[model samples]
Target chain A: MKDDLTDRILVVLSSVLMLTAVYMIFFYAPTERVMGIVQKIFYFHLPLAFMAFLSYFVAFVSGVLYLVKKDIKWDIIGSASVEIGVVFTTLVLITGSLWARPIWNTWWTWDPRLTSSLILWLIYVAYIILRMSVEQAERRATFCAVMAIVGFIDVPIVFLSARLWRTIHPVVIKSKSIDMEPAMISVLAISMAAFLLFWITLIRIRSRVDFMELRIRNLEKIKRGGME
Target chain B: MKNLTYLAAAYGIVWAGLFSYLWYILSKQNVLVGRIKALEGDD
Candidate 1:
C-alpha cells in the first residue's frame, strides 16, 4: 500500500512536470529568430539527449556498485537505468529528426551530433536486448553491468568524435565560445528542470515495476518447488 | 514557402508522438491492472 501511494505520487508529479514543460515551452519561451516555431523542439530535444546521457552514467555507476558489492539491488538499478536510457535516447532521436527537418533541411543527416546520438541509441538498445537473450539472471546482470560500464565510457569518445568530425551540429553550450541569449538560456533551464523531474519519476516507476515482477516470478518458482 | 511546411511537419510529429506515448501508457497500465486483478482472484 505504501509503495502504491509512492507510485501514485510519482505519477502525479511526473504529469505535472510534463504539462508544465509543455506550457512553458509553448507560451513562456521566446521564439528563436532563426528557427521560428520549430525552435521549440529544442526545449524537449536537447534535454532528452542530456537525460539519456545522464541515465547511461547512472547505469555505469550502478554497474560498478554491483560488481563491488555483489548486490542485486545494484544490478536492478543498473538494469532499470539502462531501460530508461533507451527510451530517452529514442525520444532524442525522434525529436532530433523533427528539429533537423526544419532547420537543417534534411530529415536525417550524417551530422556528428546526430550520428553519435544514433549510435548511442543503438548501443543501448543492444544492451537491453543482450540482457533479454540470457536465460540466467545472475549471468545476465553481470554481463550487462560490464556492458553498461563500457557504454558509458563511450559517451565521451562519441562527443570527441563529433568534434573531430566537424559536422553540422552545434557545439554543446559549455564548449562553445558564443553566449546564448538570456531568453534562450532561461527556456533551456526550465526545460532541464522539467526533464530532470520526469526522468526521476520514470526511473522510480520502472524500478518498482521491475521489483514487483521479480517478486512475482520468485513466488511462482517457490510454488513450483524449483528451489531446494 | 518553406516555413509553413516546417511548421506543419513539426507540429504533426509532436502531436503524433504524444498520442503514441499516451496509448502506450494506457495499454501498459491496463495490462498491469489485469495482472493485479488476476492475482487477487487467485488469493
Candidate 2:
C-alpha cells in the first residue's frame, strides 16, 4: 500500500515536471537566430534521444543481472525497460524527421547516424517479437536476456556514428564543449530530468503489469489442474 | 515564425506518442486487474 502511494506520488511529480518542461521549451528557451522556431524542437528531440539511450542502457544492465542471477524479476525489469525505450526511440525518430524536414529540406537521408538509429530501433522491435513468440516462461526469459545483450551492441554504434563517419547530423556534444546558449542548456537540463522521471515511472508501472500477468497465468494453470 | 509548423508538429508528435502509449498501458493494466479479480473470486 505504501509502495502504491509512492508510485502515485512519483507519477504526479513527473507529470508536473513534464508540463513545466514544455512551458520552458516554448517560453524560456531562446530561439536560435538561424533556425528560428524550429530550433525549439531541439529541446525535446535531444532529450528524447538521450532518454532512449538511457533506458536501453538500463535494459542492458537488467539483462545482464537476469542472466547472472537467473531471477524472473530481472527479466521483468529488462523487458519493461526495453518496451519503454522503444517508445522513446520511436519519438526520437519522428521528431528528428520533423525537425529535419524544415531545416535540411528532406525528411530523411541514409546518413550513418540516422541509419544506425533505425537499426537500433529495429533490433528492439525484434526483441519484443521474440518475446511474443515464445511460450515457456523460463525459455522466453533466457532468450530475451541474451537477445537484449546482443541488441545493446547497436547503442554504442548509434552514439558514435556521427563522429566515426561522414554524416549530415549535427553533433551536439563535442569532445570539450557543448554549443548552446545558457537558456537553451537550462531548458534542456530540465527536459532531460523530466523525461528521466517519466521513464522511471513507466518502467515501474510496466514491471507491475508484467508481474500481474505472470501471476494470472500461474493461477490459470493451477485452476486447470484442479479441474482435471 | 517561419518554421513554426514544423515545431508544432514535432511537439505534437512527441506528446501524442507518449499519451497514446500511456493509454495503451493503462488499458491493458485495467483488463489484467479485472481478470485477476474474477479469477480470485472463482477460486
Candidate 3:
C-alpha cells in the first residue's frame, strides 16, 4: 500500500512539475537579447545535458551495487538509468543542433563536445544491444553490469573533453567575473530546478515500469512451468 | 534576413523535436500498458 501511494504521488508530482516548467519557460523567463527566441533552447538544452550526466552517474553507482550485492534491483536500476541517459543525451544532441544552427552557422560540427557526445551515445547504444543479445537473464545482467561500469568512464570524459579542448560551448552561463543580469541568473536557477524535477520524475516512472515488466515476465515463466 | 531566419528555425526545431519525443513516450507507454493488461489476463 505504501509503495502504491508513493507511485501515485510521483505520478501527480511529475504532471504538476512538468506543467510548471512549461509555464515558467514561456511566461516568466525573459527572452535573451543575443540569442533571442533561440535562447529558450538553452533552458532545455543545459538541463537535459545535466540530467544526462546525472543518469550516467546513477548507472555507475548502480553498476557497483550490482557487482557487490548481485541484486537484480541494482541491475534494473542501472539499465533503466542507461536507457534514460540515452534519451536525454539524444535530446541534448538535437537541441544542440538547433542552437548550433543559429550560433555556429552550421547544423553540425566536429567540435570536441559534439564529437565526444556522439561517441558516448554510440557506446551506450552498444551496451543496450549487448544486453539484448544474451539469452540467459543472469548472464545478461552480469555482462551489462560490467558494461555499465566501463560505460561510465566516458561520462566525465565527454563532459570535460569540450572544456579541455577549449571548445566554443560557453564555460559558464552567468559568472561573478563576467556576470549576466541578476534576473537572468534567477531565471536560470528556476529553470534548473524545473529540469531536475523533470529528470527525477522521469526516472521514477521508468523504474516503476521496469519493475512491473519484470514481475510480469516472472509470472509468465512460472505459469509455463519455468519454460523461459 | 539570416539572423531572423535562424531564430525562427531554432524555435521551430526545438518545439517540433520536443513534441515528437513527447508523442513517442506516450505511444510507448500505451504499448507497454497494453502488454501489462495482456499479461494480467493471461495469469
User: Of the candidates shown, which would achieve the greatest lDDT relative to the real structure?
Assistant: 2
Please report the candidate that would top DockQ against the real structure: 2
Q: Which of candidates 1 and 3 is the stronger one according to DockQ?
A: 3
DockQ of 1: 0.30
lDDT of 3 by residue, A1-228 (tens): 475476457656645664665577667778777777667677667777888889888988988889899899988888888887888788788878878887788889998889889888898889889988998988988999898899888888877775588787765533345245565566666666756765675676667667777877876777788455
Worst 10 residues of 3 chain A by lDDT: A171-180
- Model 3 agreement with the true structure over B1-43: per-residue lDDT tens digits: 5655654564466446544654555466567778878877876
> TM-score winner among the candidates?
2
Query: TM for chain B in all models?
Result: 0.89, 0.94, 0.89
DockQ of each: 0.30, 0.84, 0.33
Error (Å) of candidate 3 at residue A35 is 3.2
Overall local distance difference test of candidate 2: 0.89
Model 2 Cα lDDT, one tens digit per residue, A147-204 = 8899999999999999999998999888898888888888889988888888887887
For each candidate, what is the lDDT?
A: 0.74, 0.89, 0.74
In the range A31-96, model 1's lDDT, one tens digit per residue, is: 778778877777777777788888999999999998888888888888878887887777777877
Tens digit of per-residue lDDT, candidate 2, span B1-43? 5588888888889888987887788788789889999999999
